[model samples]
Target: MALDTLDLGVLAAIVLAIVIYFTKGSLWGKSDGEDVSVPRGSSRDLVEILAANNKKALVLFASQTGTAEDYSHKFAKEFQSRFSIPTMCGDLADYDYENLNEIFTSIDGFQLVVFFTATYGEGEPPDNAVEFFDYLENECDDLSNLKFSCFGLGNSTYEFYNAMGKKTVSTLTEKGATLVGELGLGDDGRGTMDEDYMAWKDGLFDILKDQLSLEEHELVYEPQIKIEESVLTIDSPEVSLGEPDDKYINPSQEEAQSLNEGPFDHTHPYLAPITVSRELFNSDSRHCIHAEFDISDSNLKYTTGDHLAIWPSNSNEHVFKFLDILGLSEKKDVVIDIKSLDPTVHPHVISPSTYEAVVRHYLEISGPVSRQFVGSVAQFAPTEQAKAHASKLGKDKALFHEEVTSRYLNIADLLHVLSDGVKWTSIPFAFIIESVAHLQPRYYSISSSSLSEKQAIHVTAVVEQEKYPNVDHIVTGVATNLLFNIQLAQNKVSNVKPVVTYDLAGPRQKFAPFKLPVHVRRSTFKLPSNPATPIICIGPGTGVAPFRGFIRERVAQTANDISVGKTLLFFGCRNSSEDFLYKDEFVDYSKKLGEKFELVTAFSRETAEKVYVQHKMLERAKEISELLNDGAFFYVCGDAARMARDVQNVLIRIMMSERKVTESIATDMVKNLRVLNRYQEDVW
Candidate 1:
């Protein structure tokens, strides 16, 4: 039993490792060092994170992109700031649901668990939430001791409004989990998600006030992260100037080529060449681009009726404006390192990047400013008077709406309007990244059929440009305008005034042939399994994208000597001469389909009275009713707020009138169609 110095050192190291394992938790996908660095935006185990943070309640989020995640973080902060509750927010995908039962025994409090889930496409859970959802529904059952609260983020326009939220609440209750608050539902379709959330939280607080003995505190601004300025310049080889990952930041020729080989996905998109790009419309005021992406070498597969999510960069115009307002114009190229002060929270965007990179490639500097964000940034106003003005505006929801949201004024514009051209230099850079959402991918319904062309994905996007009454700058969509620029360059179209430009060459000329960063998002809106199954499509404007795919598939089926069923498409636009999308192609398809296909047109601006798709649907009530009776699949892809709602009502009326059924019966029939997957939608 001789204890040598080396033996003692080895023993000490083993003890230290065990201590770190329990205290700091697993380094799981992190660096194994004294100072660990977790990858930005990556999820960690919720149970471990909560334990390490010494938290009581854990807010688990099932986010599709980042909206649900944003809400979860906001709720966590509010729970702490308002009620003095120690909370931990985490992604549902990052934790094991099997250990959920242990939470009741581990945390000695009433506020144990909370769920925030976003419903994606029909009643499906988000991609990340899929595994967790399966476990909850199939595996885990006994959750009697689990006390939880729930909230749902969804669009009311969809048939299954807040479906995921409802499912989560019901499943948890069925499994014997104690529900704390009334399940909150937020509808983005009504443009009142924030209001709905606030209303729900107010009620939840009333319940929690007595249950947790919570005390309201004065709201104060707190930074979740801290920024460390780096010595690296924007031009430095190691510095990532808007490059998506480390591979793009600094890659050898072989590494770069290997990166492009396979697994072309959301994280690493293939720079697929654009084979075709042209204007689909003949309108002087509006422009719609039809672009075909060559995915021959991408190893990416997509069926008809799927979505192509194009990752877009912020326009230079908006980037410059934001940089100027933040007084980062002079130091745009200055590289900075962002790290989360709280071990539980992660930095929103990838770091070791320049200010210009973060602004141009990551942050959403275009959308309407939130009242909470306005309040958060008010303390950093250039002057005391400006601060007071901003604070007052933030406090008054109506005034904030009237001044900021109503005017579509973003953060840069709001600051400019309040400070009268003075810069908000005192505001921390980390706050901008945390406050503003990341630039999301614009999902377009695929217009090309997989049967017609397996190696290409077609997109029909109408460039959205709106001019406000008093605002000088035209509000142009970032992704649509980017697509327009790409089309211009591809077709050798002359540079038009007000056309938004991008770094089309991309970082280091990676995209050589008019390529864009994109990924395929599989959608539920699909053609029936059998070619003989009838289909009735209602698509107005660019909503006609997926219907185009469906028709193309039918045309291919007919060419192959396969018998096809009756296909009816109700399409609406301003006028057939100007804005009718794929006019020539439809004519060719109609020739092949003959009696099997029917195109119902609605030109709103052609006559004194406006005629929409819903009106066209009513005109063909007998046909639609007959088709539905024969088990026809109904598909709607367009404006969910008005067009989809109207078309749905028209269909119900058709069922009532033509079938001679009661309104309730017609409604049940429609609901039954949805339940049977006969009703499909691809609306935004």
Candidate 2:
């Protein structure tokens, strides 16, 4: 069966296609000699890496937004410093876990593995941990010699809180792994994540001391990374002044154009132009921005229900204040090169970068100060009184919360208050880099349908501003206010000043004219594949974001003469005239869809009694029950703390009343819907 010339050509073409698909056409690209790939640590074999390094303990993290990773590094650092046991910190995604037993048996001594995992959307393991979870569940069988501990980071408001961390412990135990201590769960919902982590660390240390016959050393600060002040100016091509990667720093014209091209992801973001920016609400005190990004040129794609990750920069005010407090005001523009001293530790910021760039773009400079961090910084205090105050705040939880946490004081704010405007020149810049969490991108539910717009991504964000009773300073949201400022700049809104000033022009004025660094994140919260499947969307306030996409999606389908579903949206706001979002747009949708579309309004402040979406949902209980019976998809988006819960409860009540079922049975029915993916939520 010798192949003909045409058959041979076809075979060659197929092979070429396969190569192109796998390599994303990089196989036939121009040679630059430089590796564009991210620096993942050497070696994927966990046991081999540990054995080579002579590390008795391995701390692995599965992080979504760097929190879990940060905790793992912190744990590894402390474990080594206190127990004198060399520990290696690794990303779970980087290491292979097939030889789990070898870590204990093949290693020099009884090796220990510690997991710090954050549970992502709906009890799912984060993107990086998926393969590990699959292996643990289906492939892995034995781990008799394994000893492990786990600490989970999560928001208590979610139903499946700390699910991945708990899963790790349970699965490992089932496979004969011995658990060292109780699984630790850090709750962000209660604002006790830091405190919870601290408590867990102390308890874990106590257990390790007894079990391993380890001697505790004084927990002195040791910098994992070396930061040296470089002679390079900000204008130097080698210096990184807020650019995400090497490719973004002073690229050629062709390279600049390529930045907007795919594959846009978490590592690579597209510099999207702001096509539209306007305020949604008419209220004076509060504001909601409805901004649209033009992805026409960029190859970035999205669906009806997805998230847009907006990379933001710290405000000029915050950055300057932080530099001033740290006594790095004059040296802010001076370039500094950062190199990791330990093999396991990776510097978060790109080097060589300026102090201003690190503060503005790399580190989270405007979040609540950590209690443990306060105690750590006490030694670096400018005065004895400041040191004592810091020590007291660190030791006493109540006082720390009262003075720092409740006041929404950041690192600089806390330092200023602690020393009464004295500069803390003793604190090492490397310590600052190690202590603070890396600045993370904020995600918003995209408000436009890809089917309708195709090339545009819409974001509906409510600018968060909270004025506490005792605190004179208002706590402003980092990302939302940034978006608001961008909106103001784009629209040329005069006479009204921005709440916070940002370097919107970006590095080297690359992002000049209104632009933002954005990437799309796919979500499971999607519309049904069948166009005729009815949907009940309860989204109060800005939670209505995805539902708007849902409605517009159905409208788009209708334009194609497709049999559109009976779309129902329950929206609640403070007042109908003031904060009713997308009011006119919904009316236009209603006109287009006619009897198929329904907009249920719940204006809380309009009446004597404050009414919400749940109350409105209850009013349409019979309709909801019928829709459920007819295989309608149920969706809820908004505050996970209360609104989502209330809506779920209301749904259960609707089922119980309409179907004459018991409360338990109704609850089970709702749970079943969730399991079947008929019910979904996009809440924060």
Total clashing pairs in model 1:
0
Worst 10 residues of 1 by lDDT: 31-40
Give residue 429's error in model 1 in angstroms: 0.7
Best by lDDT: 2
Off-target runs (Cα >4 Å) in candidate 2 are 1-40, 252-254
Model 1 spans with C-alpha error above 4 angstroms: 1-46, 82-86, 108-110, 202-207, 252-255, 261-266
lDDT of 2 at 626: 95
- TM-score of every candidate: 0.91, 0.93
Question: Would you list the C-alpha lDDT of every candidate in the order shown?
Answer: 0.83, 0.88
TM-score of candidate 1 on Cα atoms, chains taken together:
0.91
lDDT of 2 at 441: 85
